[model samples]
Target: MKKVIAIYPGSFDPPTNGHLDLIERGSKIFDELIVAILRNPDKNPLFSLGERRAMLEALTADFKNVRVDVFDGLTVDYAARVKAGAVLRGIRALSDYEYELQMAMMNRKLQPDLETVFMMPAEQYSYLSSRLVREVAKLGGSIQDLVPEMVERRLREKLDPAIKLQDARKMKPGKRA
Candidate 1:
């Protein structure tokens, strides 16, 4: 089998179970699966860069061919640097496909050689997303089913009742950006 290195890039805000599934599957197709945790400067992530990387490393600790790292810049730029065979993307639904398709095309334009391979995960995690997981957890709801045990605990730590209450106290009402 010809060895190929694939880069799976994402913010991995907390690296949900869905993300784990993608990495696990990506490992089988590519000789090396690099889980590049993106440091998106635009959004205020609930977790810090180091915290996000730690979560990802913990989640994919068992896969022999799966490695975790962080990248700050355009994903296509990083993919080119690592000579990635193709950018690995997970498609959950039609909406997701539409967005990912746009991104893949743009990446292709940026670098003609770089391609994107879309992987559809198993049905169990087809609807799972970090956004919904965070919303549920932040509202004091159980997230045991949405993520791994360690990730559940970590999510709770960041969205603990005490911490949430403290944040609410710090919020300024009727403030416009």
Candidate 2:
């Protein structure tokens, strides 16, 4: 039997629990799930593509059917190139559905064979988003349940370098950023 493959594309600056929820559920629905990272250079991302890929890899290491990859240009084209049966998306709210629905229709127009599957994250994660996670971390707020432990650590390292240095100095007598 031919494998049923689906592509899940996203920026994933820091993979949050909500994203993981979708990935976990999507993985079960498809024979092979490709977690493709969008190389969008237009927007400044906190984590590099490589970093995001690594985080995803680590988080999904246990899922043998799920793989992490990167791509540029149209997502539908990428899906076609990979021979994906569907483009999987996670919709958290109506606002997201409005934008994603338009994109899904556009993609369907481009590749009639490729279908778009929309999945919702768990209820606890309904209101979670990477943007909000970044904002909370930037403001030095707790993000314990928002993202994975590794991502939380990385976020603190990236957004609070000065704070870390100040903390270290207080602990010792010299450390600086």
Candidate 3:
């Protein structure tokens, strides 16, 4: 029997609960699920590649069929290199669907044999996103429910220093305000 391998590629910059939800589900469907983190230089990510990789590795440690990896360049290219049979993606809403659909079509064009599988995360995380989680954490909002505990801790450790610096800059130098 042929082993079914699927690649779930994303930035995963401080992976949120929504991402984990998909990974958990994808793991069950494929013989092996590779959570590939894209090393995108175009966008300024909150977490470093190593940090993101560590977080994902830790989060998915218990999943026997799941593994985490970092990749550069095109997802389809990486998928092909890894010999993945399919690419797993999460669709949160219409906006996401439109974007994903275009990418999936292009991926199909790029790799004729590789298939794209779209799955929706649980209803509770339909609106959850890594960007939103970062935004909320940046503004001193709680993200306990949006991410795993380890991720939440890492977010605080990563963001709190900058937040504290900002707070310090706002305070009067010699006055106890």
The lDDT leader among the candidates is: 3
Candidate 3 on 1-177: residue-level lDDT in tens?
999999999999889999999999999999999999998889899999999999999999999999999999989899988999999999999989888999999999988899999999999999999999888778766677889999988887889875565456558587442
Per-candidate clash tally: 0, 0, 0
Task: Give all TM-scores, in the order shown.
Answer: 0.88, 0.90, 0.90
Encode model 1's per-residue lDDT on 24-120: one tens digit a residue. 8899889899999888889788888898888788778899988888888888889878878788999998889889989999988888888899998
The models' CA-based lDDT, in order, is 0.83, 0.90, 0.91
lDDT of 3 at 56: 94
Question: In candidate 1, where is summed lDDT lowest over 10 consecutive residues?
Answer: 168-177
Model 3 alpha-carbon miss at residue 85, Å: 0.6
Give per-model CA RMSD. 7.1, 4.5, 4.8
Q: What residue pairs are clashing in model 3?
A: none
lDDT of 3 at 85: 97
The segments of candidate 1 whose C-alpha lies over 4 angstroms from its true place after superposition are 162-177
lDDT score, candidate 2, position 24: 97
